[model samples]
Target: MTMIFGIPIQAFLGQLLVGLINGSFYAMLSLGLAIIFGLLRIINFAHGAQYMLGAFIGYLLLADLGIGYWPALVLVPLIVGLFGMAVERFALSRLYGVDQLYGLLFTFGLALVIEGVFRYYYGVSGQPYAPPPLLSGGTNLGFMFLPNYRGWVVVASLVVCFGTWALIERTRLGSYLRAATENPRLVQAFGVNVPLLLTLTYGLGSGLAGLAGILAAPVYQVSPLMGSDIIIVVFAVVVVGGMGSILGAIVTGYVLGLAEGLTKVFYPEASNIVVFVIMALVLLVRPAGLFGRDG
Candidate 1:
């Protein structure tokens, strides 16, 4: 058995794989939060609810309509994104220009309501979602056995995250989005639909959350409480990465996840709190966040 720093290589790589899996979820989720806050200036506490909603919707689709993972993977986000747009239009849109507290409170309340309904129906035990047949097995690496679905999750997340980054940083539409956030009135004067843009941006954020949810269904239990369990860590990821900093959100998620995994290897007791510890340290040194422009 090959050893790495006193641990078997297989054991080390196994933990690292776990870290990457967790990091994948973290990156997608924090990216969503960062996008919404960055562009909309609203802290959407309903995000976790949206994530739960996605999982539930996917579950329902499979249980009732015979929709499979592939379809759910596409449809779930679209549906959730549309729901997010509706919320932005009818509820969140009205809160703009008011105290930020109002938006926060409203989203928090929305989360509770959604979770309550789901719990009432699903009873919080959790539902099992099987991975697609194509991704049902594992591949043996030199050191460890790698699950196909897990590998897919990592690849899909990186593709989506970087693809999103490219869209915002490299495209003309992205330019308009950034500009609108900077000066909506000016952008509107230039014939841009700022409100619509904001609505779509929020939808995109929510959709990312949903996508994460669905991808996670096979890896973890699909439950109303699932989102709540992960959202807090995702928020911590956002904070440490610098709130609203897209690049920061993506990077910090993976970094903290790896740190957490390694901590579990070195100090199992500290694994759970590692992300929070990093958040506290980052806050003390730089409240603006690692990538945030604000101070």
Candidate 2:
């Protein structure tokens, strides 16, 4: 058996694949964070809760209504987006003119409330969600066996990331979004509905989290506890990537995941700390992050 750096190639490749899968989740979650922070300028501490809500919603749809993965992928995001809008209207929106710390505090409290409510009803035990029949098998490539759903996740995440990047970077609506992020008052003078745009942007961010949750449902146990488990590492990923750039978030997620995978193969004990270590190094070298623009 061939080896890379004294580790068996098959083992290395398996870890690499696992890393990519984890990276997909990181990328999706961080993308949502980047969008919310960029446009709304609020640190959405409730993001993880919203992600959990997405998975739970998807699971309920599947169990109760017999809805499948494909439709839930589309509808769950919408449901979560609406939930985000309600949050903005009832809770977050009220804080728009206050100190930034107020927004952070509000969202943190909201996270606790959301998590506590779910815990009260469901307990912390996890539930399994089956992958759609179409994505249940694996293909044996000459190099390795690749599970179809895992492959689909990688491709879908890439497509969504790049598509979002293009939408924000190239389109006219995206142009307006960029302008609003830069100077909302100036954009408003040009006849754009900046507040509405802000609401929509937050909704979009929350919707992405929802989509990620739905995607993750089949892979991870659908539990109220899922978001709390991953959100910290994701925050570290956002810090490393630079919180403001969409493309940077995606790149950082994949790179960090690969790094973690390599660590798992060579030094199992260091794998968990690797991301935080990189985050520290990035903070020391570039406090604004790998792609952030200093304000």
Candidate 3:
């Protein structure tokens, strides 16, 4: 019966929850984009397809092979990562020395082929992916009733996002990745296999996308088209975050998500456009995003 700013408190909380859930996906996808763009200077249009592949792989593992979610979570990314590595090796690697536009175009064509193939086989309809048994229920959190699956999603995504940030910003492997990003020739001269590092980085980025897809499967419909639908919004998030910074990607995603949720409560009409609007504002003011370093 209580209301906050003339909206039912429950409704407000619910929308906020939805926003956070959407934000989790945005964070993961944009993080991958940042990684690729910062290092390889490629705008990978096929990331959405990679995400779809992740979900499809997870579903196939469960429905056909009788594998469960826990294991699928681990295996799906590895599978998707290998696929990404192969794409980079055979297809994308050739374009590295050329104009960056070529990289974009190549990935865009690859995205189309991937999405078209999946649509041909699976159609555009959504498929349900049930949450694991342990995450199917909800908890009464006094102020809000939270679904276990959603809670798990937020927590798991936070862990992955921060963990990745730490690994890249703090660890020795991260140092190499950064070094490769900054000066590949120098890093190569130092005996770090730069090309292999690039491949691994691409695989790692794509694998993160896959992991996100697996997390999203139970929360959203598992459909071939799901990736395309969300990818645009994520791209906007990346733009607003500025592609140079990893932490910026993570922060932008969660912030925009909460902003969208608040907008839905205050003015439903603006919720969809809020992200783009923020991106425009960021371009006008900072031009490098909240946490981005000037390139």
Candidate 4:
């Protein structure tokens, strides 16, 4: 049997592929977190709930309404994004002038409420969501058979991550967002509608989470506890990547995901804590994170 580093090469490749798929979710979620935190200075604890909501919404659209995955792909995010915007307008907006802890507590409470409601209705059992008919098959790469949907997930996630980075780093509206993050009062004086921008920024972040959830639905079971399960790792990714650095979040997400995968192969027991261990090391060496700007 072929071996690399005392492990079968095939197994290694499989794990790497799995890591990439998981990394895709990490990148998308962390990117959204970075965006919201950068502008709103709010650590959105409800982000995971939003993600679960996206999956549930996508599932409902397909199962009950007879909507297919293709349409749900577009509609789910729009619906959740509007819901997020409403949250900002009706709830989070009120906390802007108060202590940051208030925002954190409110979001945390919101997460519990959303999760509890879903639990009451759906229970904790996982619900299966099938992929679109087009993505039902697998491709035989010479060394490994790759599922078409997994491949699509990797490609889609990359496109979304890069697109988001370009929007935040290269576009004019993104420039306003960056400037507003620095000094909203000054940006407002310059005629930019900072308040509206803030609302949209939170909506955009929430929308990203929704998109991730939709993508994840076919890969994982849609369950009430799904969001809480993944959000902690995502928070670690955010901390390691630096709160406001968009590119850092994207990079750290994939790297940590891969690291976690490799750990599973070589050190199964440590796999769960590997990301946190890396996070702790990163924090000890550079409190601002690998790409964060020094204060």
lDDT (CA) for every model shown? 0.92, 0.90, 0.90, 0.94
1-295: candidate 1 lDDT, tens digit per residue: 9998999998888998999999998999899999998888888898998988888889899999999999999999999999999999999999888998999999999999999999998898989999999999999886799999999999999999989988888999989999998999999998999999999999999999999999999999899899888889999999999878999999998899899889988899999999999999999989988988874
lDDT tens digits by residue: candidate 2, 52-89? 99999999999999999999999999999999988887
| Candidate maximizing lDDT | 4
Worst 10 residues of 4 by lDDT: 1-10
Which has the higher lDDT value, candidate number 1 or candidate number 2?
1
What TM-score does candidate 3 get on C-alpha atoms?
A: 0.97
Ranking by TM-score: 1, 4, 3, 2
Badly placed stretches (over 4 Å) of model 1 are none
Candidate 4, residues 2-97, lDDT tens digits: the string is 888999988998998988899999999999999998878999999999999999999999989999999999998899899999999999999997
Using all chains and alpha carbons, the TM-scores for the candidates as numbered come to 0.98, 0.97, 0.97, 0.98
Model 1: weakest 10-residue lDDT segment is 286-295
Alpha-carbon runs more than 4 Å astray in model 3: none
- lDDT for model 2, please: 0.90
lDDT of 2 at 233: 89
Q: Over the stretch 154-203, how does candidate 3's per-residue lDDT look in tens digits?
A: 99999999999998899999999989978889999999998898899899
CA lDDT, candidate 3, residue 288: 80
